[model samples]
Target chain A: MSETGDGSLSPARPSRGMFGVSGSSDTSGFNGLATPVHADLSTPKPYGSWYDEATDHLAEVFGGFGDAIERIVVDRGELTLHVKREHILELCRTMRDDPSLRFELLSSVSGVDYIDSPRRLHAVYHLTSMTYRRRLRLEVATTVEDPHIPSVVSVYPTADWHEREAWDFFGIVFDGHPALTRIQMPDDWIGHPQRKDYPLGGIDVEYKGAHVPPPDERRSYA
Target chain B: MTTTDTPGTGASPTDPFAPSRDTTEGRIFTLVGGDWDSLTDEAISGTEKMVVNMGPQHPSTHGVLRLVLELEGETVTECRLVIGYLHTGIEKSTEYRNWVQGVTFVTRMDYLAPLYNETAYCLAVEKLLGITDDIPERATVIRVLVMELQRIASHLVWLATGGLELGAMGMMLYGWREREVILEILELITGLRMNHAYVRPGGVIQDLPPGAVDKIREFLVYMPKKIKENEGLLAGNPIWAARNKNVGVIDASGCVALGVTGPLLRAAGLPWDLRKQEPYCGYETYEFDVPTRENGDCWARFEVRVAEMRESLKIIEQCLGKLRPGPVMIGDKKIAWPAQLALGSDGMGNSLDHIRNIMGTSMEALIHHFKLVTEGFRVPAGQVYVPIESPRGEMGYHVVSDGGTRPYRVHVRDPSFVNLQAVPAMTEGSMISDVIAAVASVDPVMGGVDR
Candidate 1:
């Protein structure tokens, strides 16, 4: 829920002579003019300086592992960490129990297929720490050939269905899941349909007389 | 109020693992399947238990969710939840559509927080393309305003349904009344009520309409008072307190361990709001507070959402006040089309580019336009993950692009799906009625879950 960069995020200047407030420190205008009715509530802090110490501390603890962390971008108010596959579960476990990095909540687990990239698949974890008032992301890249990642269901019970979904759609196998059944798609359905290479509308063998047109051949409403 | 009953009397006799039988392995040798049915029937009838299906279509489920409940009188012995009644396969279909067209498809999935879905997808695409900063200010403001509005709308539905579950019929009516105003605003801006494809790549579909600002202002002024009135209606009521207070309790440790977020996490006495901690969409600019409660009960979640609506109102007001003039879309003409093209006027090829393409270059403009619309833009070969705080919790997109027009992998981390897991832990030893209260408190929207 990061606010887009509008001037509203920064703390408003008080009105008058008192720091940034108006005339009498009660209602006086910033200048000599009449008092304004309302106060601007938006508060802005220097972005980099605000979270620098805490983030730096975590980075220090991460030490050599920091090099494998590809992207550490903040957007729309979330701090996302793009870690390679080998370190994802360890990072999650550390983030969960570490005093400073108490990301106890494993909020979500899902898979994304980067079919075009050298490492073709990604498992994304969203974690929140109630104690630290922070949120962190962990990402791992794997290829389609061996799309396997350790399951976090042992840590977070909610990972059960989420892992099943990733397996059902993208075909990313959670190695230690209790039951990786198709939660959405029928259990017998073939192919990981959500994979980019999977056809949008496959040949309807039941309707052998007709051909299902590809996406572009259909009518355009726009 | 304590009822002490024997724990394992109902275990099957002929099955040997049945509780009615002795624990030793020697007891198993004495029993066989032939007389087991009669023995189990007699033991079960004496013990008293029943099995009931709550829904693939029950009102308390809030959507098409089926819960199989094994109950011993008023207490639940075991519960199994069944889902997937509304699987549209939007993720599968996304591979077939172009990148831009995927916005409309993803927006329809959650239904409650459409903008969050659109933003996550756009961020992933931008990451893959290495064009994160191409989004313009106006588009950003529109995105913030709409997303906040969606959050408000989503919380309203949660409040409405939560109230209905508590037997407070008036709350649902009033909650929905406020929600319709937000929907009207969405329709006015995006042309659709629930799923608005207004937030697209590079920028939004179009700019806000004239008079949209004033309407939002009026709604902002009117909403807080209505919120207070609704709060008064339920906040101090005796039955409401009794039904909600200690029922379905989950502490902060359990919440964090289970991956819960949004109000549910806040209600557990944590200030882990994505807006405050992560600061997406300029939420840092808005003057508002993240409401939190320590009880971690059904009532606490209800209180958090009620307070969140007020904070959201403050945000909407700030956005409207600062609604300055600027272009909504970014990037050169190569990526996004110029905003001035008329529909029918292009039919006769009256434009210069049309003439150049038709007479000189063999309809190259038409071909490029066709390809752009048909195949969509190809993204670089990479992966990007983006997360947003929707009303449910952390809504995120994990995108993988293979240098193709369609996304190679697009997965949504829907909050409802994550939050639903908290149900079993919350309901384990509770009475059957409290199970309803517990679920309503967590506020799982099955649309997001089943997706």
Candidate 2:
């Protein structure tokens, strides 16, 4: 554990706000407001109707690799699996191939940059199984310095462009992606635009020669 | 331009062909000459190929979309679509504005189906606020009605544009003519012909204007006859059939693998409509059929879209019948919009009564108005992805709020962006002319694609 410079000991694990910008006071009248950290919660047995059976079947299938899964969260009637970055491809393959867990369609692949966390770049995948009329979300996170995850394009060819987009926006490297060049941005464009620290690049609005500053520099609301 | 003809002139300035070079296989030659068959033969074989760039400005392309094609004579060997020409950073812009104002930004994403974009984003924000179940019943019915009308309008544009691209110029007129009636209705309610930010987080911007239901009833009656007229114009015509049938074919498995949805998926014989699969906005209570076709071709997509308009008509009629007088917005004043936004002679503004009360009645009322308008309401810290069936396909908004007035991050999983990826899979190995049909069938609104 490390000291947070205020005589308070930080959590042993990498908690939220570990990497956020320090010393900047919030101007939204919430100056010392504490955002509740989303701690991993383990659901008790019989975790809803199909959620239990699905987890049990997954446990049976990935018997030895069950440790790679960090947490299983059931929130707002949706199931999400926090998987270790290294085992995402294997889990996706199993999820797609297994008849009982036939998540045949990759609904979307997007990246969320949680700059406050140690593992800042979160790659979110939404999988839909038309046969079973079910959907599941799989999430994997990696640090800014070493953000690499195996590409799932082999299992779902539709992930090819999405991986490129994730790479283009959040700078999360998808290893083994066939030509993972920038998809949305220009090939020569600078820095990943979607990261929290990246500037919004909004130009000042000049209406009738009156100047208005950009959104970030406007009246602070945190 | 001057043309010179000379044979075996290695150094002659008039030579029309580049100097031929010897290879292990044979002589590799660049045909700058006027011979057509030799060039076609060489291109057809593995010896040579041509690369062509289609419009970021082409008329047939729905908007600013560019495609790089590798051509082997007239057959397309490969097709690569380059999007993002119209990227406006709507998702990035939402972080700067409050939750209620986000509707104005997202409504511009899919300009043809602006209501769906607004509805989807509002639903996600509502879900994040944990007020999904608290939306008023009247508001839900209005949402259904407005969404169905937008669907018909969007499908009309597709039909008109698709017909014009396939050389039926008259469809452009008929489709736009029928669509104008719906736009009039939308204008009557939302006060904008396009990009109406009518759908809000708690409810719609306002309740239905007087006689709005009767106008919609008139449109419901008038639209079916026009749809039949459109079918009559193209359904039995051999030229249209030849241009569409069996072209741009992708089976159900291919569509699933490529993550294609909406009519393109339905055309491939999959009845996977989000309205039925995962109902939102009280869609489960509405009676309608998810139209599907056997073949996933340009023709099948056309048929599915047309059939969907009829089904939308059915849903609209049901909505009109179910239109009971009730409040359109939620009762929670803290989260609900403070004023009934109305269009005046100048532009949109707070109604006169609201302005008078806030300014003259009480100081507390004035303070409440200022706080709600400036800082907006704060949402609890959380993340949610709400998916809805839009005109094109499944439109999902992944919104994250860090318990603040402004959103932390908002990512729209726009159907156009995801569905546009299937262009290459649909166009490759088809004729050059078929590319138009294929792209039109997918109906990728570049505004949504690039956003």
Instruction: Estimate, for each residue in A1-222, the C-alpha lDDT of model 2 and write its tens digit.
Output: 001111011132233231232355543423433343334454445557588899889988975456878877665556778899888898999999999999999988889887777788989999998989888889899998998999999888889888888999999999988889998888898888888778776557789999899876888864
lDDT (tens digit, per residue) of candidate 2 on B385-424: 7889998998988887666677778888888888888989
lDDT of 1 by residue, B1-451 (tens): 1112243443344444332334654332232446667757865776855688998778999888777788876788787777788888887777656688888889887888888889878867765555667778778888889988888888888878888988999889999998999999998888788777778777787778778888888888888888898889889798888989988889887876777778898999988777888776677888889899999998888899989988888888888876789888775443564333222444422356554554576565554455455445555434455677888888878775544456655778888887787888888778999999998887887777776
lDDT of 1 by residue, A83-102 (tens): 76666666666666668877
Give the top-scoring candidate (lDDT).
2
Q: lDDT, candidate 2, residue A159? A: 90
| Per-candidate DockQ vs. reference | 0.15, 0.25
Q: Which candidate leads the pack in DockQ?
A: 2
TM-score of each: 0.74, 0.87
Superpose all Cα atoms of candidate 2 onto the true structure and report the RMSD in Å to 1 decimal: 7.8
